[model samples]
Target: MQRGYFFSAEGGEGAGKSSIVSRLSEYLDSRGLEIITSREPGGIAIAEQIRSVILDKENTEMDGRTEALLYAAARRQHYVEKIVPTLNEGKSIICDRFIDSSLAYQGHARGLGIDKVLSINEFAIEDVFPDLTIYLDIDPEVGLRRINENADREINRLDLESLAFHRKVREGYLELVRRFPARIVKINANQKMDEVFEDVKQVFDRFLVSMGKLS
Candidate 1:
């Protein structure tokens, strides 16, 4: 039997992860796979409330650790309520963003420390990490500009961070790739949407074949 997979699409702002996730899900669905997709800080009612508190523009006074804790709380709920159940039912779960986001944004960029953030998440998630993490690599300048130009894009608290901060976030992700080379794969996201998704498809094909899901 083909094993169900858990994949998380990750990147800094404007890296087009959300769009890529939609395309990835559609591609997987058409391939006759049972799949469920979700986004962090959400995909559940209680977690969605926590996401609001974290992303609220009015909550400017939120502390870094508080924000980190809130993210972990939401993630725990999402995983237990959505991810685990979906995976148990033998469906692939593709989450838009996951623990890596907290590691990059709150831990590295916000100066809270990556290991600390990871420990918090490890406690929440135990030994369960995504089966694979697809990193969308893009220059922060290009990504930010794309985000600003998109009418459908909504600015969240993280989006309001300084360009330099976003740069740090990118650097953080690169560091993570170095740390977990076996589990994370980086894809150039600066290409045109068509080109990017083509690259994404190739990556998915490779991963599926490797796992005996595709030949």
Candidate 2:
């Protein structure tokens, strides 16, 4: 049986994760490979509802633990409803943001502690982790600046966080990279868009090569 591959794109807000993920998906599709691209807290009806609750501006009183739990809940639903089934059919899955986002944004930035948050997530999906993750590395200030300039984008509560919070989030991701060096690939997102896409393509190519899916 052919093993399925999961590629997760992660970074702070406005780090160009979505754009790069789209490009990567297009590239894979053009190659005539089976691919499924999706985002966390979504990919299914129930998960999208959960995402609304987490992103609602009126939910100011939401507790950190509550937010974490909600994310894990949505993630579980998405995994079961969409991700797992697609993978079982032998398709490559490219997801925008995954456990790392929670580990960095909630655990590190929100002071919840990575291990504590991870514990709940482990329960959520029974420790079904991604096979590969791509970390888009960029300075917090630059990322925030990009968000500010993108007036068409919807600003979330997290977008209002202080620069220090985003910095901590980035640091947390770096720590995760150290912990799972083999599973995570770091890409400098500060480069030009084309260059960033090229970096992502290189990493993905290597993954296919390793699996003997590419020459």
Candidate 3:
């Protein structure tokens, strides 16, 4: 029934989406809001298994269309098992990534075609798009540099892609802004992490205001 709002955060690697989502969920909790924070490709058990297959560096022979399909399969499980039920139960959700990642990574960067990837995702998400999508915009080089500094970070198949592919991912996001201008908000993430989160807060505050959750 979606008694509360859904917020999805989008960005390239090292854009600090996980940290931002955690902080926002904590803030909402402090404000007496029931907020659930999650991430895509593996939010629950079934989806986590699918995520592993998609991210495995050993799966170098995986086809582009296969990768996209795996993502869609995981997404559908996550939504049905976690997201939809949480929203229906009247809890707000903040997802670290969503269909937008596929549109950028598999669709555009992998040369699978944005429209093709989007069409595949449509069957899973079923038009229940995020009420708000906050995109953290940073140059691909800068973002990749940050990723390189994190040794503890899990190295996925996508992380091993050439810098050129990541740049295309960024371009794909920009194209998405043009496609869904009203729903996607761009934020400069080149600054300090705290600065980025402050911008996230402001954007979320506006959404809450619009929904009459704030005065």
Each candidate's lDDT (Cα)?
Answer: 0.92, 0.89, 0.90
- Per-prediction TM-score, please? 0.97, 0.96, 0.97
Candidate rank order under lDDT = 1, 3, 2
Write candidate 3's Cα lDDT for 135-175 as tens digits: 99989899889889989888798888888998999999999
Report RMSD (Å) for each prediction in the order shown. 1.2, 1.2, 1.1
CA deviation > 4 Å runs, candidate 1:
1-3
Where is model 3 more than 4 Å wrong at Cα? none
Error of 1 at 20 (Å): 0.5
Please estimate how well model 2 matches the true structure, expressed as its whole-model Cα lDDT: 0.89
Best by lDDT: 1
The 10-residue segment of model 3 with minimum total lDDT is 1-10
Instruction: List where candidate 2 sits over 4 angstroms from the true fold.
Output: none
- lDDT for 141 (candidate 2): 95
Q: Write the per-residue lDDT of candidate 2 for residues 99-129, one digit (tens) a residue.
A: 8889988898889999999998888777888
